[model samples]
Target: MENEKETPEERRERLRQEEWKGNPTGNLKDSTHRSSYGSLVDFVGGMGWKGTGMLIILIIVGFIIYFLFFS
Candidate 1:
């Protein structure tokens, strides 16, 4: 068995099975609904204050630009 070679597709399938075992909940998108504020808090909590601040600033600037020119 040690001398036998695995095909590329077989190796890929084995790796995928191992990853699936580690994460039994493969459906990561099946999350509960959250309010906008709650979602924002969760995002900030997941990706530190600096990242969250930059995102907020960008969103504010985008809205301002939209109102000034697009609207």
Candidate 2:
């Protein structure tokens, strides 16, 4: 009865909300991604190529520092 009374736009929005409720990917910051390396990959992917390159440079620098001081 309520569905029949709803306008087309309202029905469409309701359907979209229902679909979103069933979708696991609706929340990018959910614990599932944060529980694994997926979060790190997502972070790097969100950054452009330049940022990724910078991250690599930082990692290499970190490794070099560790080797120089600890190893």
Candidate 3:
């Protein structure tokens, strides 16, 4: 600390750069979020049953894989 020599503006800009280094945000809104809840419900309901069936299929397949390949 005693030997540090950065100017205040340089220090402030460095701090700003450091603060911004790891923060990432999407540059735009998802098209999905732009829809109303009613639309979302309709969209999700349209696929909900199929997705649930697929999930069950996946769980069964995963168990098969575990026994055949791992156990």
lDDT against the true structure, per candidate, is 0.65, 0.73, 0.58
Judging by TM-score, tell me the better candidate of 2 and 3.
2
Estimate the TM-score of every prediction. Answer: 0.42, 0.46, 0.33
Per-residue lDDT over 4-64 for candidate 1, one digit per residue giving the tens place of the 0 to 100 score: 5886545655776787678767624323335323555446656666887898899999999
Comparison by TM-score, 1 against 2, better one? 2
- Candidate 2 stretches with Cα past 4 Å from truth are 1-38
Which candidate order results from sorting by lDDT in descending order? 2, 1, 3
Q: Can you give the lDDT of residue 51 in candidate 3?
A: 82
Report the alpha-carbon TM-score of model 1 versus the true structure: 0.42
For all candidates, what are the clash counts?
0, 0, 0
On residues 1-71, what C-alpha lDDT tens digit does candidate 3 reach at each position? 72288765457556655655644232123223444333443454455678868977999999999999987
- Looking at model 1, which ten-residue stretch has the lowest summed lDDT? 27-36
Q: Residue 9 of candidate 1: its Cα lDDT?
A: 46
What is the lDDT, from 0 to 100, of the residue 51 in candidate 1? 83
